[model samples]
Target: MAFTLGSLVLLCGISGLLTGVWSATIVPVKGNNCPKGWTQLDCYCYIYEDERRTFADAENVCNILGGNLVSIHSDLENALVLELSEAGGVAPGGGIWIGLTDAVSEDDFMWTDGSNVDFTNFSGGEAGDDDGDCVAMVTDTGEWVDDICAIPLPYVCIRETFRH
Candidate 1:
């Protein structure tokens, strides 16, 4: 949707007389904007790295690829990522690192992307330990596990789908 400063000013100018009735065009973004080798989902792109790497190393790799570790916000997104990773044959007990971490404070997880963490899917007895600071998702259930940051594991990365 196109926004004009004049329109906003006019709306503000009329706020005293009006009772909150206004309208604006809502624009829809096109899909298929993710980079090659990344899967487009909503406005974000995701990729599952099969190679084992420490949480820090995985984050660095993601940074080099123009993104950070994936931060899941919904069940649908979690399921989608798990499906994609399972396509590469990750076993049930095997896990893939995500962006959640509590390295600074035990049991206080935060996303690397710096977005609001409104959703979480920690498994039973998980994310409660001080030693397990980093997070990984079990490929079979898409549930979370709190593991040490130094443990090597596969990981996922996500970034906004670029627009032309």
Candidate 2:
């Protein structure tokens, strides 16, 4: 039987899934690497903004800085984010906006940077209960909760480390 291109692509997709060959969230950087104030992790760079702003406003700020709101893909990243928040002087139990949100389709969270939703560390019963659409990490506990998008909070931004 002759194999069509579509069938070949489908087979490759299924094979990748079965083999656990998924895409990576970190964007590889070259040359210059992260700026002086940004923290580098693997190939991605992150920066914590202490000023509080609404979710949309925070994202807009990140866009201006050449990145999007930070997306946590693993426990290590989450911990680092928590540490960053603390280092940035977030108040006890204060929240920091992350990139996860379900605004487009309620209860269906996605990263603002278009990364796959492969990992999550929400607190118990979170990402639900109609708590608006945005997500914020409780700085003191590193636990995540869905919250109102309009609420002002500090946030982190992530981007590929700068290049020459």
lDDT of each: 0.86, 0.89
Per-residue lDDT of 80-137 in model 2, one digit per residue for the tens? 9999999999988999999999999888889999999888888884565866799999
- Please provide TM-scores, in order, for all candidate models, with all chains considered together: 0.78, 0.78
Q: Which stretches of candidate 2 lie over 4 Å from their true place?
A: 1-32
Q: lDDT score of model 1? A: 0.86
Residue-level lDDT of model 1, residues 45-147, one tens digit each, is: 9998999999999999999999999999999999988987898678887999999998887767789989878889988745655468899998878899888
Query: How far in Å is the alpha carbon of 149 misplaced in model 2?
Result: 0.6
Per-candidate clashes, comma-separated: 0, 0
Please give the TM-score that candidate 2 achieves against the real structure: 0.78
Clashing pairs in 1: none
